[model samples]
Target: MERGNRESLSSSPAAAASASSQAQPQPQPQPQGLFLYHERQRLQLCLLHALNNLFQDKDAFTRADLDTIARQLQLHHPPQQKDHKWWILPLPSLVFKPHHNALTGNYDVNVLIAALEGSTHQKKVIWHDRRTPAASIDLAACHLMGIMLNTSVPRLRGFWTSRHWTALRNIRGVWYNLDSDLPAPQPFRHETHLVSFLDNTVAQGGEIFLIFNQD
Candidate 1:
């Protein structure tokens, strides 16, 4: 597969932001019958692009960094080398900052729930991860939380000074990546929405078929 090669795909960050703006209003209603499954592929491609943007950062692919990120993100199955031998096997992984998770970062659940809550009056749908310790999240998980939540971007830029740049330049950190074959992080599909839609369909004597692809 080629990297960043699609003409149909958005080429610039500005283009991506444009697509997001357009998609935000009047989110297309979930299709019915067989067509519902067809959207899965489209969703996956969007997800892959989103994850690429989320996890792209400066970091080394070291074991210690991977361990720390996995612990922070509550990721299961930390990376391991074949036969537990040192310097004998090459591992593949995605690297990112120590404080964030590749999937949704720290603020995913909270932001998602809040967004949904403001949009609808449905019952709250809880997120579950088998690898997570406690089953809840808050809003502080966003990397630049204060800038994103409390102030406008233009105002935030005004706060970045030479002192901040100097401090960042002095920091020393190794880059590490987590090796995994999992597909991209898909969009949050609220279970309540799914259940409610499916129930309404069944009441109408409509048929449903579930289609899935594992790569």
Candidate 2:
């Protein structure tokens, strides 16, 4: 073959190899799991809306405070439980009324213990009165709903009441109130460190579920 022809043949191997490689199918990268852009955008928008609601009621929730709470809720990165439900983290310690706040003098530790044992919420409550024997109090229940001290965030006691009622009615369900407080109960002031409700669905590892506030 002529020198030019020989050179062409030599280069053809490289071109052929390239074309063959290109022709072979490459596995398309699996799209990163369920976190689609639209979903993320929707969540962001919802979060913003929630923040905006908080802002409009800034007196009830200061910017710094809201940001802090948002960060806490955002830190959770658990997988989604279902396509619809929101995720929430239960703070068992903070959910119940503190010992000092129960001034009704009906310090039935067993009542609190029973409530804890009976709690069916995602975050179960277990009262340990023996752990701190010095505290004189009864009626122990997880601080399912509490007010952030010095804040005007209203307590949806009625909402909790309804949830309790429903939870009590449904034995198969895993969500419920600790116990049914007796009527004509002792008067006790509300004092707690819980912030506003973030949408926290229990299915995913850690996601904020939807929060419903009446009023």
Q: Which prediction has the highest TM-score against the true structure?
A: 1
The per-model lDDT (C-alpha) reads 0.24, 0.21
Show how many residue pairs clash in every candidate, following the order shown.
9, 23
Tens-place lDDT per residue, model 2, 53-117, is 22122132222333433333334532344343245444432332222112111112222222223
Worst 10 residues of 2 by lDDT: 1-10
Instruction: Name the regions of candidate 1 deviating beyond 4 angstroms.
Output: 1-71, 74-77, 83-91, 95-195, 198-215
- Model 1 lDDT per residue over 1-215, tens place: 12221111111122222222232221233332110000111111222222222223212122233334445444453344346457644332342323233443322222222322333322243332323322132312322111011111112347742100000000012111111111111221343433443344335433222211111
**Compared to the true structure, candidate 2 yields what TM-score?**
0.16
TM-score of each: 0.17, 0.16
The regions of model 2 sitting more than 4 angstroms off are 1-63, 85-215
